[model samples]
Target chain A: MSIRNKYEEELTTVFNKLIAMCRTVEIAIEKSVNSLVHRDTELAGEVIKEDKNVDNLEHEIEQDCLKILLMEHPVASDFRDVSAALKMITDLERIADQAADISEITFQFGEESFIKEPFHIKEMAKLATGMVKDSVQSYINRDLELARSLDRRDDGVDNLFGKIKGELVELIKKDGRNADQAILFMMIAKYIERIADHAVNIGEWVEYAITGYHKIG
Target chain B: MKDKKQTVKDNLDIFDFTSDIAVNIKSLNLYYGNFQALKEVSMELKKNEITAMIGPSGCGKSTLLKTLNRMNDLVDGCRIEGSITIGEKDIYAKDIDLSALRKNVGMVFQKPNPFPMSVYDNVAFAPRTFGIRKKAELDEIVETSLKRASIWDELKDRLNKSALGLSGGQQQRLCIARSLAAQPKILLMDEPTSALDPISTGKIEELMSELVKDLTIVIVTHNMQQATRIADRTAFFYLGELVEFADTQTLFTCPADKRTENYITGRFG
Candidate 1:
């Protein structure tokens, strides 16, 4: 606000870095799901290895937010943006961990076909990834409409998770030998659902950044 | 005047007066000849609280601050309308004692403007003007004032030393001590630490938190961080208008007015 060019530029860098971290998590989500669907243990390993970078990015953005908070003492929308990013980064970091967890399950599948078709789980993962991407988009663009609309998409993930859980139960009941794989499938579905929940958290933070209110409406 | 009172009544919610208001400014408008410097400003400064006024240069924050103690009366062609009452007493009312008014409302300027005298004398100067000449009495007042300003231990051995010889931060504290010596009920500071280094600024800011227990402080500052750090409440002024006034945290995190948001976020033109 003092017409200081460097302060403005540093704030922009923090914002851009947060977006980059979001992009990294989105990529991780896609790769982790792909490794499972295609039964590629190598791709699954890559997703697990990439999680370290995601963790580091979360730390980096957090430090940057704190730097701006302490050095610049941002006010109003600038203050909101910094603090919202602080909270959003935590949610994003959790989402990254969920993606890694999914890849870890994919590694356990180990070149074997699913006991049953994983169509609903795949649909759930796809919907969750879409929510993550759109939430990040809303944050970077300060798109209120996009941020508010994310809650409805979360319901879609929830529905798919419910259906996946029921189908997994049916698979486990029909044959005792398929129990282990069926439980893994259920866990993967839960992780995807958790990712969607984290995306909704990011959406709430985006709304807070733009309007200074956490309530979705 | 009647219409101005009506306007203030109409916007009572916006003014948001608490029960213990020390200074109640009601739709005050100030001008310097043809140029308006403060326009229809109304706000209540709570008792025993530190309130910070912040805005860009020439935003009339200092203008409103000067009005608190009638410091602007010295400027030629300056005129004020409406009311600013300190504890139910209209500051501009006839038969008001200017010297007594100043004694009750002390001030510290941006630059360290200590008198060219010993540190003890600088602190005692104000009390002396009001007819306290005994050495023992002056010593007691000077010591207490310096202690309250948080410069006593540092300057205890240097009491008789020339105040002008001290550091800028010390000189500023010496000025604050001088104001305190008069036992003023309110202290008005205009960029009191703008000339000091960060460590010195921290000291004065710390001192402010302690001082507010006994004296209401109104500070005008260009530093938004300083406002957030020391002030309980913050008021943002823009082009001679009061844009927003709220608790310091709320004002900095989510100011209601777009103009306040723009100015605080550095997007102002």
Candidate 2:
């Protein structure tokens, strides 16, 4: 193959690696929460081990992004994509850290009764994880509509966080002994909400790749 | 060498050549006997702007330049059709005075064709042809025109020396000075610096950049770099038709059409 095709192929590989890493983290998040809610210590070990893969892929994609930027003086859309990809990975790696933070809480809550139903937590994970996937694909395809669609869904995640906060406050007031568990749950939901926000940041970057715009609320 | 591209008839409209413009052309065609050189060409030169005519040799860039001032009238079997105008004045009208129109719109050739006379007289010659006869007035016009052409300081003391004694660069400056002396609102330059060395070319470019603030200049050149550097806007002509007309930076950096990209990248000429 020609050198240009080879370079593009390598870039495609990097994009695939990032998308796969996002998927893995999404699954790990769901599995990590399941380990606590169902008292499945087996799933907790799996979540902890899965993080090594995220760390490895993150390192590999970061190195490749740097290589592309150094070698190519790409103009216009390609320039935006490479830059956005480099930045998106930083937030992705941090999301991985947040997922790990949620996983560590599983051991802390091992002995306690279920403080509340896990539906809201599960939904937050699903929404943010899907946003991460959609943003990466939108960027790779340069699909402005898809990027904008992902951008809008962040409002849903924010609303979910609000409902979680209100429910926790009422539960704590009803039983003062529930205070510690309620606050810990709120903190976990807060981290998940912030993960949704960082995913929105990635979606905005995708919009920039397609239309050279980064407008947001 | 002049850059040439195959002029696709359907694509020529991209340059948006118009005749209703202050400058008009209609069914304008040229030939060197049996060779129908420019095919049913119709276009215009907009008022008070630098219009660049670019194409390969024999595509009739020089033919069209000469046709403007009726310089092609000297060529054997060089037939012209249709009309060209400046505002309401149709230049091709029989009653239209060729000499007077040429006086109002002066020309500079590919080579620096300064007349073989004193530097001061070369500029003074065009005004004299139009009957400006006072010696004191002539001297004043000479100094002002030379200074405007940016060569007065270099040749101020050598005004009476033979034009041939000046270097090639100086001769081109003298040619520009001569054009300025005509006090023409429009100047047509046909590859005015292709013959000079690099320094001489640089001087002509500098002079052109300076002159355009006062007069509308139309230049025909093959050098893409020179066109990019000096023109506020550029029109790319190929095979007797215009391919693109855009801002200079747009034309050079990200040409809109495939043919423009090919030509600009030096894939073909």
Candidate 3:
């Protein structure tokens, strides 16, 4: 039997923790957007509180990577796994922070109706959440094709952000009275777009872990 | 930006034949009693550098090393086909002096096979074989060889003691000192550290790095980490064939051949 059996088990736990953190960030973004759509203040509060657990999971995975690096003297693919995990956790943490930021914006709107129903903004949130989930799935499964496809998939969220900005600008111009609500909706759209960008970054790290080359996209 | 780094790494792996080639073999084939030991093997050992040969057992790594100094000549029914040249002279030429060839190239074995004589005599034996009859010259050679091998300080006062009385690690170093006593231009070592502790292995590895400034070294080792640590170029042999040869870093991290990758990663069947 290989002596690396024990190290391999520890690595499996790190992989599971990364997936759990992905799911947490995915849930946070979903709940934050749902709260805004349904005017639920309690769900927004829950998302804001869940960010700490994501932070703790990131810390735990980082510690495991460092311990394996020091103890196992990993080479070849094992070396790539540890290094990719280190970079990946940073992007995962950023996604969690952006989710909390979206939840904060939802709290500001309170129970008031949005300037317009947030159909585009909610679509952007769903797309971004799917991206975060799929990117982590690509990493766990070592699916190079799925990771590469996320780069093109990121363009959808970016396009949605541009469309939201144009619509919000027109609403503000239609009446100076809609300026406060229009600007807040635009800020929420920007936060969801940022989450999609972080997911793209995670895909790039997954590619690096598999092939040792991170595409600039 | 990555293209430039990759180009530099590629250039380092290429062998520039315009410079000095210490040892060159062309289509070399060796067989012992109809069992092929080496098949059309050819490689160039760069001067003043350490080249490590690595593979599994009976992969012909040691057979290739032995051919560098014609040590396989003693084996019964061993027939070789092809030419090997050291410098400008063919080592297998009819008129070549065996003593001169052995003098120019020295070898260290797997085990520390120091003679049963005293430490001083062991170091002096190589020089005396070439007919240096003066006491002062022999004494100077003994001191300098021990110092160069990095064992002088430990054995300076114990020169009169038998080499067999030394520890396994110390005896290995003494064997290295004995090899250096001949002042050979090339050193061939077959698993020099396989029998020593890690600390002793580290010392020998350090000594090899220092020795490469003046001598060419070819080592056959089973330990892949040792090759990555000390060798500038690594040759991977498989089933009596020269499979891949490249700079040590490239060979380990991204070997060009799948067999080389499997062997180095311990996945070989």
Most accurate candidate by DockQ: 1
After TM-score superposition, the amount by which residue B240's alpha carbon in candidate 3 deviates from its true location, in angstroms, is 1.7
State TM-scores per candidate. 0.90, 0.59, 0.81
Instruction: Give the RMSD in angstroms, all C-alphas superposed, for model 3.
Output: 8.4
Question: Candidate 2: which pairs clash?
Answer: none
DockQ of each: 0.55, 0.07, 0.24
DockQ ranking of the models: 1, 3, 2
Q: Which residue pairs collide, candidate 3?
A: none
lDDT at residue B2 of model 3 (Cα atoms): 45
In model 2, the runs with Cα more than 4 Å from the true position are A1-217, B1-21, B195-203, B249-256, B267-269
Q: Lowest summed lDDT over 10 consecutive residues: which window, candidate 3 chain B?
A: B8-17
lDDT of 2 by residue, B169-199 (tens): 8898899899888777678999988888998
Which stretches in model 1 have alpha-carbon errors above 4 Å? A1-16, A59-73, A110-113, A215-217, B1-19
- Candidate 3 overall Cα lDDT vs. reference? 0.87
Over the stretch A63-180, how does candidate 1's per-residue lDDT look in tens digits? 9889988887777888888888899989899999999999999878766678987788879988998899899889888899999899999999999998988888888889988899
lDDT accuracy of residue B24 in candidate 3: 92
lDDT of 2 by residue, A1-217 (tens): 2235655676798889878887887777777667767877777777877788888888899898888766754433445667788878877877877777777777677577877877898888788888877877787777888878875798899899999999999998999888888877887788788888878888888776666566665
Q: What are the iRMS values of all candidates?
A: 2.9, 7.4, 3.1
Per-residue lDDT over A78-176 for candidate 3, one digit per residue giving the tens place of the 0 to 100 score: 667788889989998998888788778887886667789999998999899998999999989999999888889889999999999999999989999
C-alpha root-mean-square deviation, candidate 1: 6.9
Best lDDT among the predictions, by candidate number? 1
